[model samples]
Target: MFIQIAIYGLLIALFPLAIVWASKDSNKYRKLIAVTLFLTFDLIIFGAFTRLTDSGLGCPDWPGCYGQANPFQAHNEIKAAEALMPTGPVTVMKAWIEMIHRYLATCVGVLITAQMIIAWWRRSSLRHSPWLATTLFVLVLIQGAFGKWTVTMKLQPIIVTIHLLLALTLLSLLVWAWMRESPPLVVSVQAWLRRLLPIVFLVLLAQIALGGWVSTNYAALACHDYPSCNGEVIPDLDFEHAYVLWRELGKTASGDYLPHSALVTIQWVHRSFAWIVFLSLGLTAFLCRKHEVLRANSNAIIAVLLMQFLSGVATVYFSWPLAIAVLHNAGAALLVLLLSMLNYRARAST
Candidate 1:
């Protein structure tokens, strides 16, 4: 089963590999990085879709669906599960969704592996150290491990949240690697802004993690109203149970049904932190865009930040429509990408 799954991943990767090879661009390695980066972004987006659709446990197994290589092969078992619990986690459609997500992930792993191999094989000729790709390779492995735990652990909030964060982290590292190959189109910034870059990035990461926590806990609708959670300036909250971190889904650390107050706490914290992210990212991007050399990066950052802001608001006001929710996740991934590229430029300018 594992070998079959591996073959499927390699086959999925072949199409993109061919495109990179056939492109007129002389620098195939950089082209490969670009393609890998693109797929990783898509993987993150689809991952959001998978989670939002409650397909995380569609297969309820690791690396394969019901010990088979694809959903088609597992149809009988999946059908049985769906029949057993009509609205439960396992269904034919969901099995396909979950398996497709895994397949795309495998494809990405293959591409990253190819990157590490090429980076090391051509170490003398490459501009950056092979270590970057090596690190990516390692991170992807860890991400895969978490993916398994996401299923085995039954979508435990913390593990799943960490999985989402790791995906964004991998995306950020890929952007950094890709940006290293491109000419740095940035000028030296003031010391203050230089110092602020990492700080802002850290803030964004924290916000993303909080957002993941909200999503994993099904707290998006805990307070359906915007600007005010459930129409209160400060809603009743349960920080104690909300952040226990290692509890099962929808249950407290001691295994009681999680209270509404805990859910509100999760949503409220994520909602409140958005203000800080908006200011930090917005101010940094606003300042960086003033520099002609940094205009593109800064503009992309600002545009996505606004989109992220609006999508977040719309997700709340519209009651978390799937499209908007997925876009919100995509915006988070894009921010990670843009900020990572900016960070690389900031270091290069120094």
Candidate 2:
């Protein structure tokens, strides 16, 4: 079973592997980094789809489906569960979603393994520190462990949110790695602005965490309309239930039916944080426009931010459409990538 699963993983990774190998540029290492980053981005998007579709527990087990390698072999068990409860978590559609997510994740693992091997082999000639790549490899391994625990632990809110955060962190590191290899064009800006980049990055990271919390807690629909939640300036919010760190996915700490107010609290907090994120990004973009080298990236960042904001609003107004939800996630990741690249270029140019 394990061998079969391994083969499936390899198949998924083959295209990226080929691209990395066939590139004739002397900077093969940089190309490898780009490929890895792209794959990681896809993994994040698919992970979001898995969560939005309520397929997190499709397999109902860790690393494998019903102790079998793939859903094909475990079809009987999944069908049995679905037969008993037609709308239960384990069903044909959900099993595919869950298995596809795992397969993509495995392929990413393989790419990271290759990256580590190459970094070790070329450590002597490499311009950047190989230790960074090694560290990223280790982090991905830990992230994979948490991904398993997300399922085995029964989708505990804290664990799932952490899992999402780790994935974003991994994306940040890969973006850093890519920058180290082929530094972006240098920009001349105020010294204070340069320093602000890292601070903004930290703020964006926090906002991403809040967004993850809202998603994992299934609070997307907590607020039905814009500007106000449930037609109140400050709606009745159950902070006690909403902020409890350790609880099941949708339930409060006391095991009572979690009040709508709790969901409202989560949604409101996440929505409010969007303003902070938007203001920071806007400032960064304006500052970057002063430097010719960073002007293009700065524009791209603003465009993505606008798109992200629209998607966020649409997801809520449209009742959490799957396509928009996935795009919202992809937008967050792209923001991370663009910001990381800008910061790296600034530091290296200095």
Candidate 3:
């Protein structure tokens, strides 16, 4: 079973390997960074899918499905569980979803390993710091550990939220890495704007954490409508239940079913924070427009922000369609990447 899984992992990694090898450009390292960044982006989206589909506990085990390497090898266990509770977490489809997510994650790890090897091999010739690559390698390892804990710990909201945040952090780092290798042409901006970028980045990171909390806590459907939740501007909210951190999902610290009001509060806060994030991105884009190289990147940021805003609204208005939800997640990641690239280019050019 381990051998089969290893082969599957290698097969999944082939595309990224081919991308790095077949590029005719002399800057193979840059190509490697780009490929890794792209794969990481896809990994984030699939991770979101895995969460949204409620497959986090599909296997109900860590690092492997039912102590076997893949879902196929664990068919008997999965079937037995399904027979015991037909509509429960351990269904055949979910097992596939969870395993596929694992496979993709393994492929990403392989790519990162390749990146670290290349960075070490060509450390002297590389213009950008190899330390970034080393950091990325360490991050991927940590992220993988968190992924395991997310399952082993039984989808504890805090653990799951941290897992999501780590993926975002990895995305940010890869974006930074890609930018460092083949930096965009930078035009000077006000010194104050330079100072503000880090603040904006930090704020965005916080907002992402909030979003992850909302998602992992299953608060997206907490409020069934927009502009008003359940026809009230500020519906009754049980902050105590909502804010309890160390409890199982869908239950309060006291083991009671979490009050509906608590879920509403979580969703409401996440929705409200979206406005702040949009405004921040808007201001950053406006500040960026002054630089020619940054203009296009600024436009991209604005477009993604707009899409994210629409998706957020639509997810509420259209009953939380899965496609829109996933796109919203992808939009968040793209926003992070664009901002990271802009910041890196600005720094390198200066």
Off by over 4 Å in 1: none
Q: Residue by residue across 159-206, what tens digits does model 1's lDDT show?
A: 999999999999999998888888656487788887889999999999
User: 98-194 in candidate 2: lDDT tens per residue?
Assistant: 9899988888888888888888898898886678888888998899899999999888889988998899889989988887787456456678887
Number of the top TM-score candidate: 1
> What is the full ranking by lDDT, best candidate first?
1, 2, 3
Question: Total backbone clashes of model 1?
Answer: 0
Ranking by TM-score: 1, 2, 3
Which residue pairs collide in model 1, if any? none
lDDT of each: 0.93, 0.88, 0.86
**Candidate 3 residue lDDT tens string, 1-350:** 54666678789899878877898978888888788888889989998998888888999987789999888889999999999999888999999999899888888888888888888888888886678888889998999889888888889898898888889889988888777677456466677787788788888888888888889888898888887887888888778788788988888889889888888899998888888889997899888888888889999999999999899989998988999999999998888898888787667565
lDDT of 1 at 323: 96
Cα RMSD, model 2: 1.4
